[model samples]
Target: MLESVLLAGGGSAGHVNPLLAVADELRRRRPDVRVVVLGTAAGLEAELVPAHGYRLVTVPRVPLPRRPTLDWFRLPGRLRAAVRVAGQAIDRSGAQVVVGFGGYVATPAYLAARRRGIPVVIHEQNARPGLANRLGARWARAVAVTFPGTPLPGAQVTGLPLRPQVAELVAARHRDAGRARTEAAALLGLDPTLPTVLVTGGSLGALSLNTAVAGVAADLLAAGAQILHLTGAGKADAVRAAVAAVTRDARPGVALRYQVREYLAEMHQALAVADLVLARSGAGIVSELAALGLPAVYVPLPIGNGEQRLNAGPVVQAGGGVLVADADLTPQWLRSHVIPLLADPDRLAAMGAAARTVGVTDGAARVADLVEGLA
Candidate 1:
């Protein structure tokens, strides 16, 4: 009997995407329930939330200061201000429950919701739970985690919620794999019959991924494989030049098969046509690939808290995907490993099937069910 819910998360797509997915599922299940989003004006949610047709209420960005600095000294007043606005938003929306997805806005939203005696549910997107979610989990009505071993008390493994497009792709692929591939290939100007490899380093591009994959583009092309390389932002020119340098002496029409784009608005089409994926193993992409039953070579980013590597560990162990270190993904590595995998259709299909076993496509529905029970 939930009349309204406030979904809180922002700063990155990893947070906003899942929040939106759960919001969509909640709306679909209970059309009359009011859905409102709480985010910072500076985060990606500012643009994406409104575009998704949700009512977005914003608060001032209040990043937690890790060390003693000006920000740390000012944190108290800033947090208080943010919490005040969050409470105002909760009151205005008449939110019966607050759903937090772990970002700067989450801390304040959690505080506000708890102070108002409203229930809160949390969804932690990463294997390593963030500070916001760590705090929220202390008294959340229910906790949902994308990765199995995420250290949250009383957390249920619900997997990452897939975007509508990705969920639709999963359903379509399930209905008819070959027809789905053909239709997606036509949309992306790819040949459905040819083995296709998708290489991406996220929206801003990964230097290690782009350089290593581009260096080996000719090897992949020579193996009768087509590439849909989404070079992030301005990295395409450099990748195109590297591919040209490597394949200059190759036979004609081989270069045509190497399509390098800066970005793709419809990512599901790219996912639909890919037989294998070579990319960074972010939580979102790892969950998406698993849900779609796509085999992948996950090159974990070398930076951060090493969560990317941890994120890919379970799927790799399950024989669904291969985890490669960022520094280890060289041209020589591609020649030794990736090229042969691309040539083996049986192995690719087997790996795809294995990935499907670890994936959960109904994560949004699961989270919605949790919300409904608590609300």
Candidate 2:
């Protein structure tokens, strides 16, 4: 077994969270292992890595420009400096193997590890691999991917490494799903028996998703279904206003059925109580919902390289979820499709069952096993 590991990734929660998950699993499995994280001071890891009780070494943030810009010309010098620092950190940690989660820091970490003749392991969270991982995969000792058909050479489908809260929730659901949902509902102040729909666009919020869902809040409440709209940060007031405008002349009880919050600290709690989720189909959320066997309506972000759509493809094709384009997710779409689906418990149950078939709960452990094999 490896005595120490150097974990590299950061910038966003998508990379940092999974890197931490794998680190947690490694520590849990081998208590004596030394785990060190390499990240940039500007990234989420500067805050989260230390909070998780791991040693973090930071290198300058080096972004590889996509278009031919002046920064592209300066890439080699910046990358070399980053790699030099990365090598020093690796040597100090005496890492037996380096595990990378594909972010700005990964290229330097991979090159540094290779220079020292250290084995490198990579974990790609998206179906469409990022530039860093795509480059690292060429020489990585092992490549683990969250989704099937990821175009990485010698990649293994290890699933996304879930956060601890999500992993625990998956275990609880496996033990007794109804009981778990009820307990989680109680904690979240939600009625356990209500058919609840969770609408979110991740932490930054999606204006399109919020507007579309808010436009149909009254209709959902009228169908005896409740709404838990997590309207990203700084966007709740707008959603609230939209819902209020639609239901102003209607029943007094309508407002009581709609809940709007900017964010939930414990998102797994919301996931546990949610019967169905309508949100962006990012790799993290998609894998988390699938792991819990909750049906979802995936709205792929209109931006990016279309990776969000690719991430939701497997679950949708498996009959576990529905995919809608961001532009097409209007009020009419919700009234036409979502309301009726909420009313049909049998169909909802079937969809959840199908989702479970594609879910993976042991991803962290699988990735850890792969890392251990390298040493």
lDDT for 346 in candidate 2 is 95
Worst 10 residues of 2 by lDDT: 249-258
> Candidates' TM-scores?
0.98, 0.98
* Model 2 TM-score, all chains together: 0.98
* Model 1 C-alpha lDDT versus the unseen true structure: 0.93
Report the lDDT tens digits of candidate 1 across residue range 23-57.
99999988989999999888999999999899999
Candidate 1 wrong stretches, greater than 4 Å? none
Whole-model alpha-carbon lDDT for candidate 2: 0.93
Per-residue error at 305 for model 2, in Å?
0.6
lDDT of 2 by residue, 67-116 (tens): 89999989999999999999999999999999999999999999999989
Determine the backbone clash count of candidate 2.
Answer: 0
Clashes of 1: 0
